[model samples]
Target chain A: MDISSGVTETTIKSKKTVKKQKITKGNMTPYLFILPSFILIVGFLFYPIGTVFYYSLQHYDVAAPFYNGFAGLDNFVTIFTQDKMFLPSLLNSLKWVVTEVGLQLIFGMILALLLNQTFKLRGMARAVAFIPWAISGVLASSMWSLIFNEHMGVLNDLLMKLGLINEPQAFLASTTTAFTSVILAELWRGIPFFAITLLASLQSIPVDLYEAAKVDGASRWKTFIYVILPQLKNTIVLTTLLRVVWEFNNVDLLFNLTGGGPAHSTTTLTMYIADLAVHGSNFGYGSALTVITFAILLLFAIVYLKLSRYEKE
Target chain B: MIFNNKKADKLITLYLPLSMMLCFTIFPLYWTINTAFKPEGDIIKRPLQYLPANPTIDNFVNAWTNIGFATFFKNSLIVGVATVIVVLICSTLSGYALARYQFKGKRGFMLMLLCTQFIPRAMMIIPLFIIFKNLGLISNPLSLIITYSAVEIPFTTILMSGFISGVPKELEEAAMMDGCTKLQSLRYVVFPLLLPGIVATGVFTFIYTWNEFLIALMLTNQQNKFTLPVGLASMMGEFNVNYGALAAGSVIALIPAILLFAYAQKHLVNGMGGAVKG
Candidate 1:
């Protein structure tokens, strides 16, 4: 934060030259190069998004396709009026995002800070620690499910051996532990992402700042407060914002693990919508929920961008 | 004394915590691998075996042959390779444009890429299903390849642009000024230096395609059409829930992703750092 920005500015002087190139000089080469991705994005990505909004207004149930037609605002009205699972699932989504991102951020920062120091075997340690980042959400859920299984679960075995319990506890079967269990499983995978990103940014901080803090006889906590955190300001804000959005929309682990669960205790808004789309065949209602979910995410994204002043980037 | 203090501090601050976290990170994987080799009886046996006593390949065999992870693996590989090819090509071209050229709507396009990150997959499921179903491509691998490429393009473009920009433009211009055509210069000069970055980007896209679940689940219904994630998921739903085979299936799914990651992770870390730095 002290002098890093000023240093990188002179380094990027060449990038400034490239940025100022004229359209006439480049001509249609860029357009031709970009056309394929543009076409695909428009056809597949943008078109699907547009239809999500469109179908949010129409009755498009796959099961009852004969009855499918213009639904107008009926789906939305019913979402607010008749959908009982909607509000609860929305709340669950919030709880999931806050808890998951919060824990991931905290632990990830700890892990990043830990690995940032020069030490023996640091490379090997970093490699091993970041391995979970490669595992998919479904695979992660399955791996954890085995560990949390009522019978033959290692946790239950350890607990019984230690005289903590008499018998196996179905951690995923009970509402109380289902949400937390999945969250723990996801954290195993999620933390590595934040750790990796934060670690990368951590490496970019200048050594001079730390040496200066040392010369001033600053304690470690004070050094972090005065020097490190300020330099990491943008990265922390951006990563946390991204993590919040990702955690909010993430449904794969929950979908596979609990299937929105023993008492719907773990059904996130996205999970609920996905359940509706995949199982209920109520495409209209699901689309409406999708719209609502997107609106929530959009609102969060806008608010977060404004708060962080990151949109300017 | 100062050196000793530093060592002690590093021990307190670094090694202990890193080791603890590493155990947490690697345990699930270890358990999966451990379970993969264990006999079914040994998996459920009393007094849990940390080591697989009488390790067997039965689970792998069962998952590959009986549980149809063979098909899943093949399908995942096909989709992943195709998506990687398309994404790398499109994103490289698009990324080069963003990096090297100035154009109208460039800011708009860049902003569009950023905006794509926030779009929920739930929103896409219904419409994508309808669109694919209408196209009679619901069970087709092409639908997955197409959708995966599109969804991935925006980010990959951003990544590729970062990579492209890191390559000095003067080098490309120098090649061009040396009486080489633009494509020729690009082929001869820029492509070599850009290979690592391209591989990094390609690996990222491949992993995404390989591990993607919801979209794959939404698009595919046929057993043969199922990707690794979808196949593993379907197996998890069985009433008895074959723990050994499931763990084995998880292992099979884990291989390509983890292997590719192990290979490309250095670039990934650097690429990621470069991205956030900008």
Candidate 2:
């Protein structure tokens, strides 16, 4: 009787402890797990974003801090009415986004479709095609710089050999060709991104749909239009929106290649802001520009998503 | 006759376009490599040698020892590895929580993560510069590491969550029923399966940190502290750039990213596709 009572008592205690453990795990474990990421993101990202707004209101030029104080609407006003570079740079940003993302999408879609087709050495071909995506913007700029170089560029040599140009043109230095050259270089790198994303979307497409289209006597072009395009709609919308934002902010190639120069012709808004932050010490004005850029991007995102109804099937 | 038509169609539609894309994709890389191996004098030699006549490693030696690319390479590696560890730890924990539990703010947290995708990375430079300056972390690798981790965590967290969700819940339950502790169950049951996802995420983060130029340029002023991209940019800005050394430096920077991509690319595509599809 004593042994049985002892065993029963210990079993009851263990059961109670298990219940307690369950309660704690259910309530606190997940929060604890999430705590580190929450802290770092909030401390670094979200907090810094808040400070951009705060600094935008004051004259916080690191070059001349003694003149810093509450400037109120002056910063925003200067950006709107007085700043000469503002409107031009904004327009340049629009042009840059349109050309870069548009061309990248078209070429990337073509590459994706081609890669989707079965052939020998497809895996190796896919790997080679996607290689440029792994390259950094700076590296791409350097590689293109070599090709666009006046003296040593293979491009100039080829163009001259083909009687296209009498002399080696300074592709990057000339204002007329600078933006286009940069676009082409960036296009080389950017196409791989779309190709990869779209290819993934393509892989997920049901094979039955294609067979059905074929059975319906659809030509390849007709099938692509009727079957493939509809399946890829969501991916296209999402990737394009993402790419628009990404390409808008992409200052790497422009910064390294042209430095937004040759009469400031290629100075997109983000590039202009980057120039301000780096070369100019006017943190306040720069922050103000940043705010405007942020608002424009947020507005664009909202309008784009609404028009596309990205959330809806 | 039917086969002949099919063959002609394939030639026009597939092989021709495919070859053009390949040339467009491969030419720059090939040119860069060709330039890297050529003697500096022959680099700009007229007739533009498609093949280097006198290939040499002098540029590589010069860039590595004298031009401070070695330092840049080391710095990039340090930042890349450290950022990967931090992102992996933080993201894995949060991913586990997101995948397994029923929490009140789960949906809100997910929405917040998605919202970060829209945050303009370029605009953050000024604020981040100030924040780092105030913290006295300018020119410090820790700042880059920490900042990169924060930048990477949301995406990685989502990725990890997707990967973790892919692991069957029943497996974990079975391990638990086998009298293993929760930690033990996870260690034995889930982690082995999650290794590929972890590796892909690490490579993705590493590549971003390695190639990041603008922020690295802002955060570090001392040349000794420069990353590969910053170093390359500075070299490009020099009045008389050594084209050979520049090409060599690029090849060095390009290797790790390309190698890592080649290794983890299959998983990366799937993981990224899954993440975006969600």
Candidate 3:
């Protein structure tokens, strides 16, 4: 009705028609833009995942190619039934993830809180704190290795100077301490990840919420429990899930630092799978192990996300 | 009373703990750099020199020329730069589409991106190795670059779309209103605005490709094609495991990552926050 009669209406109608044509013409642009990424992800990521399942079903070993062809469920069967390393490595993976993620969360939250405080040199402190987050796993392993060296390590040197030990005890040599040793080294690097993520979330919290708590005369612990914890819940859940997946898959520190160790004490499931892939030459078995690893992860992700979601509701 | 409380609190709360943590955080880095500069004799001395008494660059010389870190560094650079360029181009385009388009299965596309996060990297190695071996790409730089691009795309796409969404749609539309094509608008108007996000994403992708150990370890059999992390790991596994040369090589590897990270740290924080929120 407000078209202002036929002459004006024609111009507006023509404009609308042109706009529709342009929109239709631009429809292919999105698909075109996504083509390269789609190809790469499908080719490298998704296709490889599919082949993992395929190769698991067929006997394939690189070094001993004599045993190659359809395996059916045999490769999977051997992993669960016969492999000694499977159970222990799975246990180690659990231990690695729990201790690593748990400690990283606590320390990261503390670091985030401490860094969040208004102080001079805050920028410099934050930058310095995040430096470890930037370095590679191998570099981190190397840095920590130098410090953990029994004869030349500053750690042993400091302990002796402080009269804390009678002699240089090899921390990473014994079974009891080797896992903890790797955990600590990983923690040094891992803590920064939590700190960075938590700090970002912490900064997002409205300052007035704190001011409101203070005005109500809440204690510090009460303020954090009531105010900070609730706000950080979602971030904590998501980041921890991401961290768990990452830590479970990570094998570098163990591989380089201890070479899965003096007694196979520190071998995680990822390390075990990596070992099979690298040295075992049992491709079908390795692929089967890869498939099992995938199943465990899928189960984990589903359960964790479900539990987290259920808890949220 | 508050001022008095503040000063005491500052001492116990801020100054002491911060320094302790900072020291814990910094000492390893300091140790690595310090060890890099020391001669062989000084490194293992019983009364440890906290500062190098006789600092020398001989370790650097040895690592660079003799230990073949020179080759490793070059290889790492090639892979890292190639991966970043490919990731940037791919992710930026995909990100733009996700941000602006209302195509079918867009939600599925986003979900697929999120789902990729949980794909165990350990598992990826098996099939990737087989795939590369089949393609005759096992020891080639192309394998690493391609895999890295694939490995990085999902997160970077997510990061990038978050960034693109932050840019107002009005800007692109306005450039179109001024008779520029959509591509022209993206090239001129949007790209300049998106540069910081691009830099943040690029820096992250570069650092990842540079430092990634296991994939590089699996893919390359030849010693010459070894990236820094793989090269360094091989050194670590060596029976002799020369500490001076190892530390020196580590310092070399650390330089670009730390420098790039230092420059992009602010954008990185924002970028992560943005990605998470999106």
Most TM-score-accurate candidate? 3
Question: Which ranges in model 2 have alpha carbons more than 4 Å from their true place?
Answer: A1-24, A310-313, B1-3
lDDT of 2 by residue, A19-121 (tens): 7865777798888999999999888889988998998999888889899999997899998999999999999999999999999999999999999999999
Separately for all candidates shown, the number of backbone clashes (residues 3 or more apart, or on different chains) is: 0, 0, 0
When 1 and 2 are scored with DockQ, the better candidate is 1
Error of 2 at A174 (Å): 1.4
Better candidate by DockQ, 1 or 3: 3
Q: What's the CA error at residue B256 for candidate 3, in Å? A: 0.6
Give model 2's docking category. medium
Indicate the DockQ of the complex predicted as candidate 1: 0.78
* Model 3 Cα lDDT, one tens digit per residue, B1-278: 75698799788877888888889899999999899999998898878888899999999999999999999999999999999999999999999889888777788888888889999998988788888989999899999999999999999999998889989988998999999997899899999999989999999999999889999999999999999999999998898878999999999999999999899999866677666655
In model 1, what is the error at residue A265, expressed in angstroms? 0.4
Please give the ranking of all candidate structures by lDDT, highest first, separated by commas: 2, 3, 1
Output the worst ten-in-a-row residue range by lDDT, candidate 3 chain B.
B269-278
| C-alpha lDDT of residue B96 in model 1 | 94
Give the higher-TM-score candidate: 1 or 3: 3
Quote the positional error of residue A293 for candidate 2 in Å. 0.4
What is the model-wide C-alpha lDDT for candidate 3? 0.90
TM-score ranking, high to low? 3, 2, 1
TM-score of each: 0.94, 0.96, 0.96
Q: State the lDDT at B7 in candidate 2.
A: 95
* Fnat values, candidates in order: 0.80, 0.78, 0.81
- Model 2: how far is B191 from its true place, Å? 0.3
